[model samples]
Target: MSTTTTTTTKQGHPPGLYLLFATEMWERFSYYGMRAIFVLYLTQALLLDKNVATDDYYGSYTGLVYLTPLIGGYVSDRYWGNRRSILVGGLIMALGQLLMFISASFYQNFSVSHNVMLLGLLALIVGNGFFKPNISTMVGQLYPEGDSRRDSAYTIFYMGINLGAFFSPIICGFLGDTGNPADFRWGFLAACAGMVVSIITFELLKNKYLITPEGGAIGGTPEKVAQIEDNTPKRSISENIGWAIGALVLAVAFFYGANIDLIGSFIFSLSIIAPLYIILDKSLNREEKERISVIYIAAFFVIAFWAAFEQAGTSLTFFADEQTDRVVFGKEIPASAFNSINAIFIVLLAPIISIIWVQLAKKGLEPASPAKQAFGLLFLSIGYLVIAFGVKDLNPNVKVSIMWLTSLYFLHTIGELCLSPISLSMVNKLAPPRFAALLMGVWFLSTAAANKLSGTLGALYPDEKLIAAGKIPSIFGFQITNLYEFFMVFVVFAGVASLCLFLLSFRMKKMMHGRG
Candidate 1:
């Protein structure tokens, strides 16, 4: 396994890190830009029911976005390798964003616009699968084993993600939400422009900046690309044909779900199967299996953390749009602008948190990765609790102050600092070399499940049915009704999960077999 360059010229870090940083930054700009507007476009522009948008379309789109990475990661690991996968994926995604722009250009044609939107979404989903997991893998590949900087490197990388996220909503929302319903397509067009910038930036700088200390290109296949192959394959051409047909069938199923329904089920099944397929590979040594077990355990906790955290694009967006008072200086602020709050906080806090981790490590006081993750969940729960309390006496006809949501985002950003980047570093460190990108995809599978679950939970946002029935929806005995009640559910759910994870941390660290 050729992991790192042998050459050593120590200053701060390698150039490849910043190159990937810039690439991922623009990619996130495109992604988060689209996300900032998607639900609003569905509910406000298309005039779909809010419940359907959250429960079905939003859930399916985000879920499939993560699900396809399983295919992309596997194919990259087996054949395409990371650089080629990213190049191809970037092109496809840029085209996908263009298709979305076309969808918006035909905004007046209801049937045609909707069909084009579906096609655009399909392209984005396919493109992202190839782009998301592989790029993160390249980051880890730049560093050698047991390097302390890996964690901070990912944190720095995460800031690049937030840097793009912070500006995108401001730009995209300004263009799309210009107080005119017809102008919403402009946001999608802006997203297309972001994708174009992302790929072009990558292509221009990758050769110069994306290299190790020894000047070795990262993400390229170690051997000739044509020689890439699976460890074992059936010699029969019919078997290969049969597998190709199966892939086509799966894609068709995704298309049907994208068009009509049942995407959640497909994603749930794939989430289980993809990781299991990796873990059961006969080539993994005993230590690798144990390390993988740790990833699964951590992923379970991550699902809990993200299920609540990911609501920024779903429930929180709805809250900001419909329930939060956006008046500042007597002018109403755009709801999508609120999405940038989390990113803004991340931009401000990430470097501070990165420094804190290093300082703590120097003093031998830094928490283990699992413990840090538990703390992340704890902060997430506290964030929800803070908002839940503020909304306890809220009037239905009136909106709460923006401070409440801003404060919630602040806490969530702190929690993210602890959990999200750490989890990425954990996967990078623990996964076997051959399975690197594939395991990264599996790590994202946790987020896929969380994204879908967040959407499902978003559906429980005290809609007409629950309000009309005069009964709050109770899950695990927590009643949910108004903004306060709905928010309380997450408080209890994440709080309990965080506590459980904290209890399990000691055992989990032991299971890491000195890796932690």
Candidate 2:
């Protein structure tokens, strides 16, 4: 390959879309499989002190998961190509799954030994970091600007993600929740199957349908590649070793129990993406900076939306498992299956949402990006309020019905429809062409921040003791108890955020000029 192909599927994209489709499908399955059990394992299996407030740990863990893509994206953009990084990540993740499998099998055998499982989780984190960002970038590579299929392509891609989520809980849950979920290695094995399927699917499609002929993996003959290398910038061997050593140290720290916060601490510390743009401004004119400025504003609003919505993995999941009765057809459902409800809703509604966007845009009535996001926050605020009201006045002797949780997911799904996909399009539209991928990275960083905060916010939920411990004491004039008071904090916070965002619409739109 002289110059690696970048795709631009205009009217109809290539069949390679299916390749990414299947690959992402399984990858998400594995991810959801692991996720399905993460909180459950922590609260029920590992028996950590859930009441002691583990939100920081969970927030840091999930946050870091999103954050690592920055490192992975940078590596792919600067040194290795997307294809190689994806392959490496897949293999490493497979091993991590194997480690998890071993950990489960031997949980009682090792009993107190945390090293065996901790190391495996660390590997998965690094592997996922390497894999996630690069793959998304490849999807963009498959279609150029103005490709009619591009937006539809992404919507379809998201569908693949949900497809995995849809099946994972049912399939893995059946295996995992058997007699005892805590020590079941079968769940880990199911997750491993997902990674393997993803790796194999992508590997086969790398040369065929997935990539076009502009910028992609480089595997040219020695004579062609060798000549270009002589003029390339060179770094000393010691510098290379220093970088390697740093990466190794990070890996070590990641494996430790609590130090895993190092991921969130480090990634959160990188919220200064603006400085990088400032430095590059010497090469850019006035128009580019204004364009990039819009991206940052949108990125900020999205962080708030995701932070609230992502509670599905943290607080909401906890509520489902602990406070709500998840019986369906007279049998109790695994709490994680509730997690899939969003994906299932997305799978069913994404096409309809896409159609609505098209019709709205055609009629010159498309909502401003800021408005869409603000409305999304409003949807989330309402979702939380629904739960707040639904769970109120419970007699303290019984669990709430599953219907309340289901309704909450439905509202969150609506908010998700408004915010998530639209934001992706908005960011791509607002970013200047040259820094497209970098700005996308920034957008992903915002998601990382919100997801991280999702974990942090989770700690606010009232555990059994928190209620019984009288933490919800009546303050002066008001009385609040159980999860109701805790959720009210978010309800008010989100409602205010939505209002502020709505008011900011005119200013935010002006920042975008005519971009979207």
Candidate 3:
């Protein structure tokens, strides 16, 4: 492997970090702004059933969103450089937002608007695939190998993400959630503006700021892959054809999941198959295979963590809208405003947690990445338990205090702090440099599966049937009529996954080959 000498920069971080930060912040603003009202739009604007909206459309859209990153990362690594991919992705996403604005503007024409919304989602999904992984890969490239600043840089970057997230709902929700149901186009237009800002920031500053202290640009595609080609045999045409066919089949299945009842099972099946395909590939050496094994193991745990965590955008949003009391000081706040709480907590806590990691590392007390992720799952489980308790035996006619939902988001935010950034860094560190973006995309497979699971689980949220009549529903003989019963499913799922991951941490760490 060719090694680059470490160059010093101010504050132990390069200036490129801030540029990427601003770029990601604005991108996130555009994304979360759209997400904040997506479910509400499905239900109110599109006039879909709430249960179906969350279960099918929301689940399928989100699952596909994460799924496209695999293609984006591969194309960027093999054809487009990171910078070009990011620019193209940002522009596409901006266009997507514009399409969504048109969708909202044409809300009265249900057919035209619905088709437009689908097109917008496709654009956003394709664009995000290109933008998300490459930018994060660029952040890792900014620091040389073995630099401690990488984690802190990501935390700071994460804060940028949340800062955008923190404000998006307030801005977009306020504009979108006007008492008039037909005015959502304003919110989507605001999202489009955010995307424009993101692209402009990236374009204007990349050459000036996206470089090492030594003044060489970073994240351009390398001319040759020195490390990966060694001892790897090239695939034959038939083998390549087979792989293409397989990918086509997976794509067909994913699209079918929108209307099919069996998508959850298909996603779970793909979760296993996708990692195995990577691990068993002859192109990878033993070291790469072993390192990827850690990602695969981590991916399983990822499924559980995100399946619960992602409730924020769907089921939890509904809960906030339907069950949670949003009144404070004689004012009824919009339920969608609660979507910002997780971001607010992330913004508030990211710096604190970054410092904690630094201090712990100085004392040689920092937990291994796997152990930290286990803690994340544990916290996720605890968050569910909190809400489960808060809503136990609650009346349907009266709304529960908003604190229940707020507290849940707070706990989930801490769990996210422990898991998300660590996992991102881990993938970059472990992946073969040649396939860094591809592996990052692979890492998102867990999220794709988890989102599908989340949608399926969201289908189980207290339906009007249960809420109105206080009837208990059963899943595999376990009764879940009340809010407590419904949430306990996540408590058990996350709690058990946390325990399993905790047990596997030592072994997974060993498989990491000292990369940590």
Alpha carbon lDDT at 313, candidate 1:
85
User: Model 1, 363-479: lDDT tens per residue?
Assistant: 999888899999999999999999999888887778888999999999999999999998999889888887788888888888888888888888778765546868555566766
Q: What is the C-alpha lDDT of each candidate?
A: 0.83, 0.71, 0.85
Native-to-model Cα distance after best TM-score fit, residue 6 in candidate 3, in Å: 6.1
Candidate 2 Cα outliers beyond 4 Å, as residue runs: 1-10, 51-53, 109-113, 179-183, 213-264, 273-281, 432-434, 466-481
lDDT of 3 at 378: 95
**Winner on lDDT (1 vs 3):** 3
TM-scores of the candidates are 0.91, 0.84, 0.93
User: Candidate 2 versus the native: TM-score?
Assistant: 0.84
Model 3 TM-score is 0.93
> 1-516, model 2: which lDDT tens digit per residue?
332223233336567667777888999898888777766665555666563334644666667667767677656655566678889888888888878887777666556424667777778878877787666666666665655566677778778878998888767767775548455578888999889989998887678665453544331112432344455454568855765565555555554634545555555555444224332545455766776776677667777888888778777877887788877788888877787888888888898888988899899998887888888899999998998898776655578988898888888888888877667667666665434445666777888888876766666666666667676434334545667786776788688888888888778787777765
lDDT of 2 at 279: 25
Task: List the candidate 3 regions with Cα displacement exceeding 4 Å.
Answer: 1-7, 226-231, 245-270, 465-474, 477-479
Q: What TM-score number comes out for model 1?
A: 0.91
